[model samples]
Target: MDKSIFTTNAALTPALGYSTMIGLGLFSLALAYIVRLYLVRNTHDFIIADRRIGFGFGVGSVIAVWTWAMAVMMSSAMTYQWGLSGLFWFVVPNGIAVMAMVPFARILRRNMPEGYTISEFIALRFQQSKVATGIVTVTMVFGIILEILINLKGTSVVVSTVFSIDWRVATIVGIVCVLAYSYFGGLWTSVMTGTLNTLMITVPAAIVVVAVYDRIPGGAEAVFSAVGAADQRNLSVLRPDAAAGFGITLAFGLLAATVADQTFWQKVWAIKSRDVSRTFLWAGALFYPIPICLGMLGLVGIGYGLVPSDFGGDIAAVGPYIVSHIGLPLTLILLYVLVILAACYSTIDGASAALSSIVAVDIVKRYFPGTSESKLFVITKLSVLAGGVIATVIVLAGIDFTTLVLTTYALKTSVLLPLVFAILWPRTNTIGFVGGIVLAILIGMPIYQFVGELSGTLAIVAISGLTVIVAGLLKPQAFDIASLKDANGATSAPTAGE
Candidate 1:
């Protein structure tokens, strides 16, 4: 592919990119301050928003956290590669993963209403077994770190590509901006800002999509025909290549990403109990269009006969390439940058908040029973700062996005079935839960690297599930689900009104 054919005559100024980051940072900081002053009374309110978030914010937060940088970039990249099939395979599992959380959220919330982290729930469920708790806590921590790293990486890639700025500077600015707000308001900051961020992402994205179609010759139909003429497989959603490339890997990987990620679990407990299932359902439904629309840009790239080299040897840059090169007005181009920024900010803050929950509830509260509430609160905020620093360091290391994503997915997948068994099945014991994750990590990850994604993912799930079953049958010990209610010794603080 001739990269010169796709070169843009104009690019965004570094001034615009840096100013946007600084402006959004100050705005988020102000928003967090207001929220803290008016809504937050103590550690509980800061960490989980007093477990009273309503449907609107709940739905918005779920969508924002799920939207992250990878979703924005990968959806388009996949479509650029596999056409309609890429969009189909990438999007279906993405939505399904969020919706799948419904039942689990319902069950866990009813049983343990004061839960702050999944690791905390597992600790209680497994009767305080150190091995089980340690495994889950480590995974949750790792998951949040990966979330932060990926979002930072995503934002850096987009900003640097469009503005011709250094990616390292973009990453540093991005994480610092997010931490500025997130460190103050915690989950409250995440949910409230996430609601606003959702609008930032969707509205601009819709306009960009319409503008792109209007600008192209003969509109959507012409693009469709161009893609089809290039390759019939591009138009077919059920093409073998799409399924082989994205279907199996994303199906399992995305599912694990959602089910195992603490970001969703934080929302599960933060929202009103009655609103849990509906929020997830609505969020999942609403989330479908954002990715699908952004991904069309990939199809636009394909129709234009642009390849990875056209986007600086990175297919993930295809979305930005089409937006910047297609002769859209400067205003629309900036709005597209806002879309990427919003996605990155919401998820980074959300993941940081989730990490705070784990540090306070799973590690501090669980291990240091005598810690004061004031100290615990400070530690929680510090955790966000610590997470941002750690993720920033790793992003500076310049790891491959796809490799990091797949590896995180595999690690998360190793524990998914075990978590499910622990939640819904009474016979699921610590031995089974611990053993399942241990064996999956030892056996499944190597296969993932050496053999194939589909096969390795299947092995992880099967090994984890089967290990739980065999252990359960050999040593049938039923856990009392109702006991979880009393086991939840969540520390409370005064409400804002109190």
Candidate 2:
């Protein structure tokens, strides 16, 4: 059995590896929490970190959030399974997503200076109170479930593969740690831990890329050339393969997300200034390319005969397979720990904190007013624990990866685009918002069911069509913006710009 992860060596016993990993992962996480409580707390400190993150913190946290295990593993699967064409869905359009957000940062920063959440901005813009509540609830609850599930499965596989643990137990521990640190210090905990997790994520990913290249003969070019000859269309955008042919599906998902989702907006809102936000944009833009690089490792592994021909070809399977085949050695024990830590907690904590913030800021506040910031922070921290537990249970309850990915970006149609229009354009009313969400969901479910899941790009297009058509007919129920913002007890800005 392959026990050690570097050079030639015997595998560590699964039980021993699993135990060590769990113990180690927990230790680092506990330390991260302690750092947060000692050095970071206070609502402002936790929420936005005094709005002056060092480039290291900003860049690392930004990259950490984007490099969820699903994106890393699945992107690699694309390379191994689909070749260049897979890169299009996995990388090209995703690049466009990063690009799309850049200008979006300008608009968001300029318009809603005091906006704390995407729902807050949207609720004020549309003068519809329900929309804010609905958007936050959907994003915080549904979004996190998918995020949690993906991280659990993908990270657990890494934890198991690296430490030789059973994926099931690893997932349990993974979810628990994610919640613990997140709840302990909230975003403060997330950011502090994100710095370490950043190193864990980047260095190992870089090393693996090198290792895979060396393992597969002449490295990247050879792998690309071999796969290119095997399937030329796999390098192209249009493929006859009924699934993942980046036509309407990819386009829809992108459009829906670009116009609709609040997470990006919330991040944009959180940045210190337009220049800082602009600088922050570089983080995601720079980091997204890493996936394309890491993905090539899987392609090389496939070419070198490590993975099978029909290799399940999702985001979840590629990396572990490559890592599994590497010559094991005792020297790699520390490196292996770093790789799993990078994979497991980096995004998990951010996701937990963000989800908690949404619930505490959006859901709880809606039902009750006069919420003190300190109390709200406490509630958010507690919600982090609860959210992690929920995610863990779902993973244990048998939610598969495919389900998570398919449902993840559909919210663009459901909440994002409509909300965006509601904020930027006056025509978007409560009726229009409701109409748009219903239309988007209706179109989305059937297509996901039969025509194959639409990409974020395609989802946006379909929902936009449905939303615009319905909104014109509804003729709009006007919202009172002043009253809406006042009722929400938000920072009332001057002319929607501070």
Instruction: For residues 458-483, write the lDDT of model 1, one tens digit per residue.
Output: 88999999999999999978788889
Kindly list the per-residue Cα lDDT of model 2 for residues 1-498, writing each as its tens digit: 111332323455666565555665686667766767575556555555455555566666666666667666767776666665565566766656655666556665565555556665655665546754575457546666666677777777666765567788988877766666566665656766776777777676677667656655566677667666656665565554524454346545554444444334445555566344555567657776677777775565455544453234444565665655565333344464456556557677777766755665566665554676667667766777776777778777775656555556655446656655655455566666666766666676667667655443455445755575467457855544344434545632111110
Q: Candidate 1, TM-score vs. the true structure?
A: 0.96
State the weakest 10-residue window (summed lDDT) of model 2.
489-498
**In candidate 2, how many Å is residue 299 off?**
2.2
- How displaced is residue 308 in candidate 2, in Å? 4.2
lDDT of 2 at 218: 62
lDDT agreement with native, every candidate: 0.86, 0.60
TM-score: which candidate is best?
1
RMSD of 2: 4.9
What does candidate 2 score on TM? 0.82
